[model samples]
Target: MNHTIPLALSIAGTDPTGGAGIQADLKTFQEREVYGMSVITSVVAQNTIGVQDVHHIPLDFIESQLKSVLSDLPPHSVKTGMIATPEMMEMIAAYLRNQSIPYVLDPVMVAKSGHALMDPASQDIVREALVPLATIVTPNIPEAEILVDFQIQDLYDAQRAAKVLVEELGAEAAVVKGGHLKGEAVDILYVNNRFYTFPSIRTNTKHTHGTGCTFSAVLAAELAKQKSIVEAVSIAKKFITDAIRYTLNIGNGNGPTNHWGYRLKNIPTVKGENHHV
Candidate 1:
């Protein structure tokens, strides 16, 4: 038998804390047995507690970084996180549209530490420029509401919003994350008029700093391996659930998830890598 590692790329920001952003994405890729590369859009000074400050990389630098990686080891799949500014989002959209790789967009509007990472004025640019090119867009409840410009109160509302996002925004699929729901953690996936509900018992720990980045990265990894969108999401849901269950209390506030949650023999095994892209 042969073991070959698939390569995946993350075009996003750098998190010094290693909880979210490029660090979290890379860790998730490694744990999933894929080679991970990154193009940093911004540099963030943050920890599990929160984002202290963010400095955007020059637009030219961002473009150069993309060309540098794609010109060499083109990724099997790509995931976008924490593209802080509208200009950065535009650049990413143009680059992705011209590429032939599968991509996942994690609409990271707000940081876990309660800081707004996106510009209010750039919402339109993101929706117009990037959302349509996504293989799938993973938006939490709050982010979904902003995209649809309406409040999503229940499962029904989420379903409605997902349909709109697919029909209007042109996303191939929409995963309306129900982590913010009052009780259990339920992620709702709406595609092709079918709704899949992924439910999990919520963890009591506050160490959920990198949950969003981790989830999207896992989804991208699964998709790159050729899993169907639904299958990829299912794997991601299980990965995140177990990660939250085994929460790492590494920081004083919200800590990070274990990207290597399934690496050990004792850990739960995910399905085989399909290698689509």
Candidate 2:
């Protein structure tokens, strides 16, 4: 009997719309065959349209939640997203100091809806407190730009930025996703003294609501299963690609990708059809 269940935890914000944040993370975890746990840092009033409001959970409550979960059911891997303030970063970093679990940091600075998610004052706190502790930092084009105070216009620039992030910012590894780039979506991961690229044809749709959360959460889930960083990132790239291809039109502004895309494809159907609904 296979009693080996990988446990993954996500420390992030709550998305009331169930399109991103903790909701997306949990979906990715389940998709990757992992048990998911969550410690929410903030509750967001949002829809496919945009984020209307955000309420930060108290630092003490965040601490208590982490303690409760970590004490009883320690996760094999953990990932962080959308920490709202400097206090939240400090609180999480302090708690992480005691544990040596592998962690992925999704530096969620700005929402796809064009709203600022992280406080500008908290950038330094996250860099000093969270980045160094993380096993890998997954930052998209804009987030990577913010992290190093530079612009990434192409894959060459992304490679340069990844090195800078690891050397200058003290991150163990960095993946600069090029979803915002033109043409094919080329994500670059810098690790083990090499750069690996995962390229996918850009989907011509607006169902990218949870791409970041899903990618980072899938990385965490892969790590929880003892997969190497490079292997984990490769798997996550395929996961996101298929997910975007199977996107469901959920809202007017932008829809959400289907986390169960693979499962949906696997279900038995009448033999005559060549396409899935």
Who wins the TM-score comparison?
2
How do the residues 127-221 of candidate 2 rate in per-residue lDDT, one tens digit apiece?
78888887899998888888888889998899888877788888888999999888888887787567777787677889888889998998999
Per-prediction RMSD in angstroms? 4.3, 6.4
Best-matching candidate per lDDT: 2
lDDT of model 2 at residue 63? 89
What is the TM-score (0 to 1) of candidate 1? 0.91
TM-score of each: 0.91, 0.92
Pairs of residues clashing in candidate 2: none
Clashes of each: 6, 0
Off by over 4 Å in 1: 1-4, 113-115, 263-277
User: 272 in model 2: Cα distance from truth in Å?
Assistant: 35
Residue-wise lDDT of candidate 1 within 1-277, one digit each (tens)? 2226677899888888898889999988887778899999989898877778889899999999999988887888999988877888887888898878778999988655445556768878778888899888999888888788899888778877877778899988888998877887778777766777777778788888889999999988887787889898988988887888776668888888877655432544333222121
